[model samples]
Structures are given as C-alpha cells and as structure tokens.
Target: MAQPSLSMIVEGMIKADSPKPEDGWTLGWDVVVSYSEEEINKNLASRWEKHRDEMIKEIETQMTEERRPGESSDEEDERPTCDIKLELGAPRIQFVSATTSPTVNLLLPVRKGSSKWSDKQKTSILPENSYQICLKNIPLGTVKGNYEEIQDKNRSGKLPNPTTGEGECRFENRVPDHDPSKFEVSWVVLDFSMKEGDLNVQGQMAPGCELDNVEDGKTKVRLARGLKVVKSAAEAFFVGTRETKFSPVFNVLRHALVTVKNKELPQQVGGSRNLTPKKFRMASLKGSEVKPILSLFIHVVDGVDEGESRDLQTRWGGLWLNTKEDVMAPIPSTHTASILIHPKLIYKDVLSRSLASESNKGWRFKQLVGVEGGGIALHAALQCEFRMPSIRLQFDKGSGRIQVTVDDWSKDLKELPATIHLHQRAMDERPVISVNWKFSTETRRTNSRSEKVHPALDVYKEVTGDITRWKTTFKLAQDVPMKTNSTDYDITLEPDMGKLSQCWEITEEEGETDVWDKIKNFFRVAWLSNDEVFKDLVVESKESMRKMIPGFKLGEMGLGFFLTTNLLNPGAKVIRIDKDVGFRAPGNLLLVGHVIQGTDEVKSGKV
Candidate 1:
C-alpha cells in the first residue's frame, strides 16, 4: 500500500480562486480537531443552566401582573406562576468546497419547550369571556398556542367559557400554533470563511423568520454581534505590532537561524563571527515573477584593512631607511601606524540593494580612501571593491541545496607620486624622478625597474600573481537532513570540507602579460625563506571563502523551518516524511510528508 502524502507550496502569488484537491497537491495540513453534536449540546446546556435563573427574572420583569376575578383590589396581587425549559437538537457542520476560500456551515436546531401556568387557588382565575394573552413582543422564546382552533370556535359563536374550564380560548393576538418541533427561533445558522489568514463568521436567521420579535431572528443578531467581538480579539492577539500578520512564524524563523548548530559555516565560510540578521523581506523572483521568496539582510561587519596599515608603514619606513647612509642612524620620519589607517575602514552600511534582479546580482561593497601618513615619501590612495553573490535556495522533490557564487573582486592602488628620494641630501637637492605607476591587479602595467625596491612594488606583483594562479571559482555542497521526532521535526546543515572544491574561470583582461613564470621565480625565493608564513596566509584566504557555504546553509535552514512550521497543525504529530523533499523553481519549497491529525491520540512511537 502506498503511504498518504501531503504537499505544501507557498507561492509568490495566490489566485483569488481557491485551489482544488484535483490540482494534484493538496494544501499541507492535517485536521487534528473535531466537535461532536452531543458535546456541543452538552456545552450549551451547561451555559443555559448557569444563567437560567437570571433569564427567568428578566422574563418576569417584562410580564404584567393581574389579579384573580374574585380578588380584592386592596390585597397584594400574586405574581404569575411561569415555568420555561430549553432543549437543543443535534448540530451539523458542513464543509463548503466550492467557495473561494475554505468555508464551514454550522447549523443547530433548537426545540421549543412546553410551558405551564398555575395559580395558588384551585379555582379558575380567568373571567368567563377572558382570552389567553400573547407575549409575542416579549424578548423571549416564541410562544405556541391553538389560535386556529379557538378562532373557528369563535366564528361559530361556540367559544368555550373560561369559568367552566371546559376548553382553551386563545385570542387572535396569540401566535398561530405550528409544529412544536419546528421552532425557527431555536435554530442557529453560521457561515465561517477562512480567508487571507483571517477567520470571518456571519450569522443567518432561520428560513421564514424575519421579524425582530421572532426568537430566531433575535438569536441570530446576537450571535453576529458576539462574532464581531471575537474577531476583534483575534486580531489584537495575532496582529501584534502589524509588522507581519504571521509574526509568530517569523519569530520562529529568527530563532531557528540564530540557534541552529552549523559549525562549518563560521569556521569554513567566514571566520568565527556572529550572524546578525538585520531585516527580512519576502518578494517575487526576477524574470519568472515567482513570488514569496524570503530575503534576509544581514548586518555588515568591518572588513579589516590589515594590509593597508602594515604595507604603508613598511613602504614609507623602508624609503626613509633606504635614504640614510648609516643603517643605525635614527630615522626622522613622523609616520605612525595609527595615522596610516584608511578612513571609513569600518563597514556599517545597511544593505539596501535588491537581490531579486539578475542584472543587479548580489550585494556590492566599495570604498575609496586616500593613503595616509606617507608624508613626503608617498602620496597615494586605495580603491577597494568586492561583490557578495546572491544565495540561491533550491529544493526539488526531496533533495535540497543552497548555493552562492563569488567572482567580482578588485583593488586598485591609485595616484602614486612619480618622484622619490633614494639618498639623504641638502634641503635644495633635487629628488630622483621616476615614471608614474598605477599598481593594480585589475589593470596591466609595465615597469622599467626589474628589482623590487619598495614593498608596494612587491605587493602589486604578489596580488597579480595570486590572482592569476588561484582557482577563481569555489563551490561547496552539503546535504541538509531533516531530524524528526514523534511530535516535531527540524532541519540541520553541517558543512563537509570533503565536498568543498574549486573549479571555475575568472575572466581575464585582454593584452595582459602572462606573468606565471615571474610569479614562480618570486614565490620560489619567498617559499624558501618564509614557507610556513606563506602557507598560513594561503590557508586563511581559502578559509574565508569557505565560510560562505555555512552562511548559506543557515539561511536555507531558517527558510525551511518557516515553511514547515507554518504547515504544521497545532498538536499534530509527524507520522512519516517522504524521502523526496526540496525546493522548486518559480519560488516554492515543497515538502511531501504525513502527519497524525491532532484529533487522533498519538502513541509513543518512532517517527
């Protein structure tokens, strides 16, 4: 036998018309709640019992007190002796499938109760020609009487005498007697529609009951009034702050992403850093118009300019040292490490770029700051630019993976002064003139000098060489498994270094020199002198790129949790999950699984 399957898809856009079951995939949900007719009746009966005395007192206040025919006017008149009973019929719940949204029709029939009137004396209190009074105007249950039988007797001039107690005499003012069991006043009809994450209910009076004096119409109006109160209460609780209609779901998502254990993400993708998500939004996919994709904007961390301070100090300090004839002479240079730092080094800018558009692609960070503290040794600036590719989440059937592509990266050393002082001399001595240089890996350059006289020249060579030799593309893939218990399920992603690899090309500039040989010669000498240091730097750069995988995994897990938890019915238990679970294009996360309905008793068993 095939297992029952359930699929839930949150589309970018929903049609006005509700989807039908025949659409192949049903809305992922399980009915874990039910109410029996007997249970409903019992509850109603208990409510009536609690307020029965108060209701009777209210009815008594509306009734008029009349004395017996033989009683004296001076004597205190006795209150009318009255008794009332209420009964309820079985309730019926009807599911309306043809409506635009999910709708339920609730029907409850009320049975008319018999009433008895009594007097203290055994004698008839009514006069000979007296007629039974109708309390139709009273705000109470409908009254039944034999009006037709009495009218016929009156037409024939044969109305029963009340003093003889032979027959009943109902006045024309009394309500016409119909079937005792068919009282419209006791019936309740309510329509409940589930639309746009809200519950709307409407009360309708029973058929043929239009008068406000009628019991059925009055009850229906009161029920409608009560439902309005309920709707307001529901809105207040669920629509707190109005940030999102489903704030609880978002809260769960935030908790899952922040708390879920993904050790590989911090260690491999980005170093040990806190993942602070600033804001989240949902939007449609670009071009395809697939809607409801979740996007998270993270707080930006300051990118360390370690090379800036170190390189600037070394270059200027070295130039000062090179100009001195004696190596032991104290340098007069005033450049300090702190003053050489780049302005706006801290990255605190908010991420406002759109990730949905293919043209825009990813988040971009760029900054330009004048190189500081070289004094007369150097006058230059640095321009840094990098792009963080958009993270794509895909799931088809059962397998799921999160991916990111990083390619755009460039740094330029601009405004390099053309003259330098190689030797200390008189104040008016002319400085050695050199050709202008734009040292950047992004562009090609030709230098007259063969030897690396300054550290900046070595840096340019190193950057160009590394850019050409290192693998330009890095891709990391890992399996995210759903952990399930009898009552709940969770998704966890751990980075697998074994699955991490790099294989892609970076577009090269035209007419660029092939400097692989020159880089090899330079690295050969450096490797012999500082092999461990070079190895550590390479490891650090690779580790930084690796961190992207874990970060993407964290996002994927958060989205998965948001979708799954929303589909779950309160108190429902996970019975089985199909092996196939993943994301689909056009913006959809599909989960095929089975859940034990909340109404069912769940036993202690493995999921």
Candidate 2:
C-alpha cells in the first residue's frame, strides 16, 4: 500500500502462549508483572531484619496487655527471648479474561508463637538458644489453617551439650495450604475510555459472587452463603491496596499521555494542535499465529483552524489496508517507523509563523566613516515586510540530499525601506543630510507617451532631465543544497552567498542631448559598472539580504513547539533518525528514528 502524506504507524508483537483467534480478543486487556518466589522472599527477609527489634517490642507490649489482671503472667517472661521468623510462598495472579478483573493469591503458613514454660529456672536458658514466635489465630475469612507447635529437645529446658550431641535444636517447618482459591482476592472491575481530551476510568465491584455453590446430584454444598461474605471483605482489601500502592503510578501515566495529546504549540493563536490515535487494533499475523501483533495509528495535527473541516480518512487514505492479503504482508524488520510530513505543514504552519513573528522583522545600525574631527557620521534604519515564498524540495537518492529551489525570488520578496541620516555629533537631533531609498527589484521607464515614469526615475529627475529616461532590470535565482540528519530530524539549508547568482541591466534614452553631453552620460554609466566599485556594492547587498532572509535550521523549527509545550515524553530520548526511507518514498518528507527509554519523571499539567 502507498504511504500517507501525514500519519504514523507502529507495529509490534505480543508473544502469547495460545494462538490468537481470527476475530481477535476485544473484551479487554491484561498486563501481569511477576516475581519469582526466591526474589520475593529475599526482599522480604531484608526488610524484616531491619525492623525486627521494633516489631518484637510492639508484639511483647501487646501480649502483656491482653493478659487478665489475675491471670498467670509466666509465659510473658519467655517472650523477650523468642526469635520471630516470617515466611511467604510464591504469589500467583489470576486475570478473568471475560470480565477483565484480577485476583491475587498468597500462601502464609501459621506457626506457634510461644511454648509452655518448664519447671527449670529462667537462668538456665542459654543465650545461644533461639525460640520461635507465632502470631495469634487471626481468623482469615478467605483461608483456613491450624497453627502447629515446634517439637525440640529445648522444650524440656535443657540445651544440648556440645560434646554429647548436636549443639542446635531442630524445629520442623509447617506446610502451608496450597489451594489457590482459598487465598484468592478479586479486585473490582475497571473501565477506560478516551474522548474529547481526557482519559476517563471507572471501577466498581461485581454485584455478587459468580462461584457460589457446588451441586452434586440432589445435594448442594451450601458453602456459597458463607463465601459471599468472605468475598466482600476481600474486595475491600483489594480497594485499599489499589489506593495505597497502585493509584499514584496509574495517575502519573494517565496525566502524561493526556498532556502530550492536548498540548498546544507556541504562537498557535488561530488554530489548534492535537495528538491523537487514528486506529488501534490487536490481531494475528500470518507467520506468528501465537504472537498477536498490535498496530497503533497515531497522527499529529498542528495549526489547524478551530472550525476547519478535515476529512482525515480521505487525507490519510493510503495508510489504510482493506483486505487480509494486504494486512498480512511482512512488516519491516528494522526497529524504525516513518513520519510523513506534507509541504503545507512545513511552509505555512512552521516557517511562515516563525518569520512573521514580531521578534525577527527588522534591524538598525550606526557607523562613522573616519575618525577625524566629526568625520561623516552615518546612521541607518531598515525594516522588512514580506509575503511567504513558495519553496520546493526535491530528494536526490544518490547523494541522499534534498535540492531546495527558489525559482522567482522577486515574486514574494518585498522592497526594503532604508532611511539614512548624517550628523556632525552624537548629541545632534537633526541631521545635516537625510536620504530615503528603497532596495527592491529593478524597474524600467521611458519618455514615450505610452510609458509611465518609474518611481526610481523621479528620485534622479532633479539631477538628470526628464527627457533622459532610464530602464533597469534584475534577475535572481538560487539553488541551495540541503543536508538531512536522521539523529534529530534536522534539515540544514544554508545557501552560499557567492552561489546566489544575480544580474543587473541598466539602459538610458537620452532624448535631446548634444554630442559632448551624451559622451559624458556614457562615461557615467561606465564608471558605475567598474569591477572595483560593483564588487563592493554587490558584497554590501548580499550582507543586507542575509539579514533580511536568514537561513533555516528546520529541525528545531519542527520540534521547538513540542519542547516548549512539554509535549514530548521526558523518558524517551531520540537516539537515531532514519531518513533513507523518506528519500526513497514519494512523499515530500519522511522521518524515522529510534529512542532510548530513560528513568526521567514526567511532569503533569493541562495543555
């Protein structure tokens, strides 16, 4: 299929265990991040060691308070010497595909916290001996289990003698319940929608438990009645964990995406800038049946008028594929994607706005010709007013460069109004001499009745007779070499001043002059054309032209808007840009690049 004039397509695959259905999975999506049992336990152990002292003190204080005033407090004395250990088995996550909900299960073994005190004195307890502490039977509504006591020789208050037997006591570890359903907690169902300029998400609990009863022949387990209450309590736990542990991360991601989509470009007074997805779908490709591919179509529209009518489907018609054959075509293996840009977006939307900005229109200067007493002080003021010029970009496949041509420089270039004044001193307000001149395209004039007097002719009429009419013409054309860099999508076009070819032609019709007078006028024209004199004038003219219309660094011109508005992702850095595809393609400009993900934080704000 042909590429679009303006659009972006991103294609990638998700490796799944089962083959994707032809119709595709459209109910919802699931994302699971898993950690191994050893890794989770290692992290927990480190944290537990750091706060073990504080936790033991808190537990002892609580246990002491729970004892009645008259009850025996002998068991509390051994609590201070007990050692606590926490063990958690690997966790499992279950995602309900139909409802797009999540359920988490964790295994927690119960062990006895304390053992009965023997008749032996407390002083006999060896400092090297360790005791296991068990938490109370908290009555977990979802899972049921019994605490088991540790069997060891130390229970008889006699530490094993190093010379007689093994120096350490042995305690058997309790086996935890492995039934996943007993420890499962289901989260609320969440729904998401993107519309207008906002991302909206809403979550609610299921009306009732779907797995309530087990029916066998004419008998029902009747366990669902109690299970319903337990499920409600689990839902509350899920909500608490989501709010405390996951909501902040989710909010940050949503804010970042929405901010980039709705960001407004600078100097966008009459139009709007928007970044939105055109299409997003999940489907299986030909060779990768088990690996479903995700195709996301995104587009950027900048400086579009508020109420303008735009048919995006027609404008981007070439990007769409209609049949299975076209959709199943082998995707590009390279890690790159193209960005097609229309000419209007560059010339009208970007360059025109930058040139017409108030900050870059005109300049002023003052200089003294000589240092001698009050040597001809000269001051000049110039201003430019111009219409945007038409430009063409031709990509050369061999050189990998774009030939930028400006066919008729005079057509769009307006005359520059320059006013110069001569003063004897810096403090003088009124100048001794003042001249008003205009630099522009050449002209012609004749004394014939049919020909009108040129504006420039009037300026010289006081010195030369009206009968002595003159004609002048200028021809200007330029071809600049533009180099494209893929790194930042920058296009560099700086034309050499010497290569900007121009020609000036001047002729005069001396209507009624004698031989000697005509001879003098001829010498005057010859003097003006001398190589030494003309070279200086041409050099000065080129200098002024450079100031009037400066060269362009289009890379910044295109991306400056996004940077200023904080639209681009802070965590992604452009590593390499690929313009070869664009040069080979039929579009005016195409750009592709690779970006490396960083750990930068995304700032949030309304665009």
Candidate 3:
C-alpha cells in the first residue's frame, strides 16, 4: 500500500558545505617553494653553501639569544601592520653569493686588425684560433653581455688610440648552474605570524588551497595570509637553466670549479617529549611521514584514493591520517635534477602545531634557516603531510524507521499535540447507524431435518437453528438485502421471507391493521417500523472498526455487528440470521484474482 509519501527531515546536522571524511585534514602549512634558473644560479645556488652556513650561524646565534630569557622576537615584530608591507619585499628564497670575483687588472698591447677585440676583451668570446681556448653555448636569447671597462690613464689629444688604451674591465657574462633549492620560492612563518590578521582577511588563497572537496574555497581561500606559490603541472616549483662560459676557453684548459658544502638542519622539537635522532633534518614526529611527506602532494582527489585503504588499520601506522596533503600543486610542474643530486640544498622542517589554518587555507610550516635567518640568501620552509579539515555523516534516507524517546514533550513537539487535539475536535463526526448483534448455540432450527435442508446454499436458502448451550460458528451478523438498489450506504434489517426470514419482535398494541400491512404481515412484516433500527450497540461497533483500521473508509461496506454468547445469555441467540456461512456467505466481500496494481487514489491495496 502506497500512502502519499513525504520526506522526513532532520535538522541541525551536517549540511552541503560540510567536508567529507575521505578528504584528509591536517594542521600545518601547505608549503609551496618556487625558484628560477637566474634566481638559483648567480643569486642563490652558486654561493648556497656559504649562505646556508651563514643561515645556520644566524640560527645558532638566535638560538643563543633565545636561550637568554631577556631576548624576545616580539621587539623586532613591533612594527605597525600598515608599515610592515612597505618594509617587506616579495617573499624570497635566498642563497649566498661569492663575496669577490677572481678578476684582476691587466694591460695588453694593442694589435692591428684586432683593435675592436682588444677593446671589448673582457666581455667578448675568445678568438676562434687561439691556443688554450674552449667554446661553450650561450643562452638562446642573449646576444650581448653587460660589461664595464675603464681607461688605463687620463688621455689628452694624442695619436689614434689603439685598444682604447685598455685598462681594467669587470663583468659577468652568464649565470652559473645551481641546485633546485637555490631556485626554490619560500616564505617565513614569522612574517605570516606577525601579519596573520591582514592575511586572514584578504580575498585570496595561498597555493594548494583550492580544491573541489573544499567547498567555495576557490574564492574563500586567500593568499594575502601568505605569499602565493609558484607552481607548474609537474612540480611544486620549477625554473629552467642554461650552460655558459665566462670566457670561450674557460671550459677547456682549466675549467673553473666551485664547491659548496651542504648545511644540515639541526632542529629539535622545543616542547616534544619524544626522543629523536640528533642527525634528523626534517621534523620526525616519530612517524613514517618521510617518503610520503612532500612540500606539496599532487593529484590526490576522488580518483587517486578510490579503492585504496584509507582506514586506520591499513595506514602507515594504526593511526588515522593526521596530516592534510597538498591538493593544488599545478599539473605540469617538475622536480629538477638539482633536487635529486643535492638534497641538502633543499630545506624542510615541520612547524609548531598552531601554524595550520582552520580550513586548508594554509599551513604554519617550520624552516631550517629559522625565523631570524629567512632571506634571499637563506632557503627555509616546511616538509610534511598537508593534513586539513573535512566533514562526515552518519545517517541517510534508507535507514528504515527509528523510535524517538522524546524526553521533553514540549521541546520536541513544540506543544503541537495540544493544539492538534483541540483542532481535531472542531470537525464533525461521520454519520453512523447502530444495530444489536449476538451469537449463541440457541437458534430457531431445533430439528436435524432443517439443518439438512439448509446445507446446500447453492441449491436454496433454508431455516436452521440449535438450542444447545454452545457458541455459534458465525462471528458477525451481516445484512442480507431485500433487493438490489443504489440507495444504501448502511445496513438495515427489514422483513424478508423469499427463502429465510428475519424480523424485529417489538412489543406494540395494534389498534388497527391497514389493508396492505395485514396481507403482507403474514409472510414478512414481523416488525412495525418503516425502516431498520440503529442503537448504541451498532454505533459503537462501527466506531470501534474505524479506530481499529486507520485511514480506511469505515462502514462503506456496512458495519458487521459482532456477537458472542459468552457473557449475557449462554444458551440464547442475541443475533439471528439464516444464510450461507464462512467465505461462501453472500454479504462477505472476497477478492479472487491476483493482486497487481491498485486504482484507489485515496489509499492503495487492491485486487
């Protein structure tokens, strides 16, 4: 049966904006490091070791200063928020550069046709046929170099000068090769910390904040909180480089060599209770986040971890994912060979727990160079799983039904029951008719011959009864129509003598018998009333049936008066009838075919 269905809503639970369980959530900075060939070579990687050493030294100095109770970083961060932006430049990944060049002043004699070559000696390529000379490829776009030269002496009017009286020239012809870290783009937690308020209110997001799993985040996540990350599809950050020679012959006879040592990030958790190895460069929170932790994790979406185990039991440990991986790394980014060859040049560290954003907006990451050492010369940032926040649900529509044990009636129903009951009483009750019904072993048929006569209902109707103290097989006394007609919505008992007869024997004084009644009264008119009677017994029976089966058209088929011989008169018949019994009875409605669909618009079930 299909009663018109309506969805039941449960409020105050999770909504559409809620994060899903599958999206990993963590509490750290989503660090993005970017670098370029120019920035990494001459600007950073060339002198990276020196810069790293200086950074380590600076960190050590600050660590010493921090140990002294009187020193504080607060004093340095006291600048007003407005001036800080003007004071700070773009977030930079810095490296040490050579303090001095290996150039010296020299005077060479001017020659005949090579006077032009001699004038531009410092920046030009070596002569093609010169001895002890080498050749190298220049960058694709550059056709000239930036070089400065000075005269050997103050010249007055003299004969045509040769070689422009060469003096000293100093210049840089090409950018040097550097490691990936030198090219890295980085930011500091201190900068973010001091200006957190400004960053949070900005209308952009730091790198890796935009994700489909994170709703409205493309607009909600802002980068004003931190610097935007440099990204490509293949790597978190990438920068191309070119091979060059200061002098055409420099790569041959005695190729110049520059060696920069690696700097170890010797960091220990200030407040942790766990024991970690002294040589550990990255923050090892007693976990295997090593292989999996990257400055940024790429391509993690519904398609990545679909069939994989995201459960605690199947995790690296018996713990859940406490970190949120980066979801926004660009698709075409790449990891350079510099990263593979020189790992220490890459700096990474986990920050304090408080640096993470409420949403995956950004992470508060740790840096090896420390807060006091961040600069264009120092490479510092975080490396760990980027865990973020998400939402989960526990219920759905197919859960069948539930039993609500409402403790406070007013709170749950909002006092609707009282109002409902009052309103229900205002509607008029349906009209009803009543009749008396009883069942007993005492029937009008007292002989065995009458029982035999009434045995075959298909043949004809006959009168039969029993006078013994026994219960009747019939449970109800139903109506038998005198004739078929369309006027009835109720059952009425009148005189019937075509085969079996039933009548109401009411006490009355017949002052005079009309001609029509006198003739018919002989066979069927055993009652005086024009219509069948109804009383409390019948009305109550109908009401009881209505209450028993809800949403039903009660009394549409007429009410059946139930009777029992158990209480009032044990051997007497309270209900009298002569008819077919059981499923074969004339008044009983029985469906005989297979029930498929239904046409009742008010309710459903039908045959």
**Best model per lDDT:** 2
* Off by more than 4 A, model 1: 1-94, 98-102, 107-501, 506-556, 559-569, 574-579, 582-585, 594-607
- Candidate 2, which segments miss by more than 4 Å at Cα? 1-335, 341-345, 353-471, 481-484, 488-570, 579-588, 594-607
lDDT ranking, high to low: 2, 1, 3
Clash totals in order: 18, 3, 46
lDDT of 3 by residue, 27-71 (tens): 111111112222222232222222221211000000011124675
Please provide, for model 2 over 373-488, each residue's C-alpha lDDT reduced to its tens digit, 9 standing for 90 to 100.
22122233333434324333332222222222222243222233322222222221111222333334322211111111454442212122112322222223222223322323
lDDT of 1 at 447: 12
State TM-scores per candidate. Answer: 0.25, 0.28, 0.12
Query: How does model 3 fare in lDDT?
Result: 0.17
Write the residue-wise lDDT of candidate 1 on 1-607 in tens digits: 1111111112210111222211211111110111121222233333333322221110110112346699786966556653322232233333222333222333332222222345433421111111111101111011111101212122232223212111221212323564332211100111121223442223233333322433666554643443332233233332332433543531210001101111222122122222221211111111111111111111112322212122322232232133322221110111000001111211111111111124333323232222111111222122223333322221111121111122344532233221211111211121111112222233222111122336454321122122222323332222222221111232222222132223111232433336775666466444323434333433444454445321111111121122122111111222233333321111111222332222322121110
RMSD of each: 31.1, 24.9, 38.8
